[model samples]
Target: MDSLDLEVLTRARAWLDDGHRVMLATVVRTWGSSPRPPGALLALRDDGRAVGSVSGGCIEDDLIYRLQRDGMPESPQHVSYGVGAEDARRFGLPCGGTMELVLEPLRDAAPLDALLARLAAGELVERRLDIASGRSTLAAAHPEQGTAFDGETLTSVFGPRYRLLLIGAGQLSASLARIAQGLDFAVTICDPREEYREEWNIPGTTLTREMPDDVVTAMRPDARMAVVALTHDPKLDDLALMEALRSPAFYVAALGSRRNNAARRERLREFDLNAEQVAALRGPAGLYIGSRTPGEIAVSIAAELVAVKNGVAAERVLKVATAKAALDIAADTLSACATR
Candidate 1:
């Protein structure tokens, strides 16, 4: 779950604690061009107070109106919007988009408190809600498992939040860490260099002076994790890459020029990494966005990170080196024409 979903849980617990009846709305399924994805959350208090979102405000408005007029439902019920063209126009759904939602009125907060505790403790949990009984349970879950609906029951997976292990604590790393936190990734920055470690002031991310390789080992990067090397120091970056490339991390990248990355790959082969593991390294991290400053580079890196997280093919992404090379050639051509 992302930040908004987390907020929904927080607000729901608050409302329930305040002796108010709360309805939890979840986007169970979506079709066409819906605004939010499945598993997005929205919570509405009996007094019309709400947190989170489902659609582009239209669905939320309708939900509030219904609650205000009809009062909270006695039991969990499935509701949908934008089922037809006219319905889409009425709800302001884009291009006849549709979404199915499960609305459960909550009168208990014990299960919710337990689930939130597990999430805070860095545990992935599966929450199963029985629509008819209004009963729910939380069990341990895997990172790859997602929300599932089986007609009568809705099983939604909560945290162990996605993590990002950054192998540096510099300006670029700081910027990237900030964005990663906003994207709901638990970011950790590792740097053994005293100067860099002393200067690091990124608040949300955990900063460590431990060896990069040891940090990577402790992380035990899973499919839900990503590792990026921004240190630009082969001594530090290479060892970390050696471990990360062989780990289960879904995305592993390093920041460098194309030529430098080729050299880095050659250097990695001399270490403990096998050919296959070395081949897994994604150097020259980020897309080809013609980025010249630290902030721009951070954006490019975050963009590629998101693309990989979404399972986008590597070949489909354009690299910074390729774009920079094209620009250099264009500049050279223009300069020659001017001289002539």
Candidate 2:
């Protein structure tokens, strides 16, 4: 999935180089309740096919209509919408605030290619737009200063997806790792036990047997990173969880039954972690799935992780109860009925 996105941009760059018209759109500003936040991207093709999005379906719809209906500007340009109350009503902006967009036709992929290379190297890149001339320049984004959007320059952070280090290689780990991968998280599975470690394999994921704590120190999980203890072993799970909790990793969780989870929390308190540090741990780690198998348990955990990453309520994520789980539930119902 990560490669697919990169490929799309690469194709866009190709189109630009071939002298086919193309335009880049960025959501520079948003009002209350905008569909997408600032820094969202939408690329336009001369033929009107687009990659990525910067607004609700409505905005994309309008942009496509305009592109196909009328060719892009002869030269690169920046467009603004929803600034005035009247424009907001017409565009259906959330709260009638203004948003600016940089719509540049790429004549050279050099700029974008260079920026992408820097970003891939984990170097923060800040894209600066010169409003009057409509030229864009990319530079390193400062750690202290996040990307910003002004009418003149719209700065965006690229190649900064959050990461997840799942401790323990098991069915649950595989499931959770796949989910994390789909969510654009760089995931690694760490298990010291050889038995489980041997079976550890998932596409687009790294499997390692390094001490979970050591891995934690190395990843340097930022606010964007999360550490999940899928292994039930305290020796393995505890140290990993401890290291992660001590750092800036925003989310840390452990998998266990509710009873076990409570006990685990208690143990953390004995480790000199203040109530807050211990409090950060979410045990019984998944949303209740009433799961009985490893696969279902993994799905449950993965769904909860995505919810945390997206800041969406767990209840809000759509869950499809598996046929097996549904059948099991039905069978239980019939058994109870027969007993009655």
Candidate 3:
């Protein structure tokens, strides 16, 4: 679930508490090229105000216009948009796109409060709503579960969808954390060095002064998690890599030059990790973007991480080491010709 949806729920609860009628809308399904995915949320108040999005903007406008003219529904109702070409154009949906939404009139905010509390406690929750009665229930959810609708009930997964453990507290890490958060990743920065730990002031990130290896072990990285080592200190980066590579983390990477990464791999092999685990380490992390500055490098690394998370084919991505080596060979050829 997106953090923005949480904001919608928060605002909805607040509006209800303030004696205003609130209508919560959830996109239950989408057919083709939709701007927002299923489980996206929008909250509408009685006074034709909204807090989220369904389509681009026209859909929200229509909803607001309906609310002012028709008032809130007595129970949950299913509303759809873009069933025909004319409707698609009118609602600003892409050609042939269709989306179904469930709009529930808010009579109580207890469920929203409960859901938000679970999310704050870092627990994955599934909110189930009955379309007929406008009643809902919350339950513990597994990480693999996603939003599902069976025509009568809507089950939406909400909580942190992805986690990122960054083993550094430097400028590059700061930039990466901001990007990751924007990508809906819960970020944690770990650095034992007092000098580096003291300087980390990035908001919306958990800073830890514990050893990187210990932090990695505690995180027990799963498939939805990524572990990145950016401190460039072998004692720190190598230790974290040894543990992260052994876990199911979808992306385990370290920041370094190609030569440094090669050496780091050799050092990792000396640990308890097997050959395959050592091979899993992505050194010189990021795509071949020719990035030089800290911010550019962070973007490159974030791009690669997203690619890996999305299951992009390896052959489709150009690694930094591969591209840099090719560039080096081309430079050497040019130098030899000049000398000739």
Best by TM-score: 3
Count clashes in each candidate, considering only residues at least 3 apart in sequence or on different chains. 0, 0, 0
Q: Quote model 3's TM-score.
A: 0.92
lDDT of 3 by residue, 133-203 (tens): 88899999987888888889989999888999999899999999999987878899999999999999987
Each model's TM-score?
A: 0.90, 0.77, 0.92
**Candidate 3: RMSD over Cα atoms?**
2.0
Models sorted by TM-score, best on top: 3, 1, 2
Off by over 4 Å in 3: 336-340
lDDT of 2 by residue, 21-78 (tens): 7777776665576766666677788888888776766677778887888778665566
- Model 2's TM-score against the true structure: 0.77
Candidate 2 lDDT: 0.74
Model 1, 100-167: lDDT tens digits are: 99999999988889999987876788999999898999899877788787779999988746899999
Clashing pairs in 1: none
Best by lDDT: 3
Model 2, residue pairs in steric clash: none
In Å, residue 259's CA in model 1 sits off its true spot by 4.3
Better of 1 and 2 by TM-score: 1
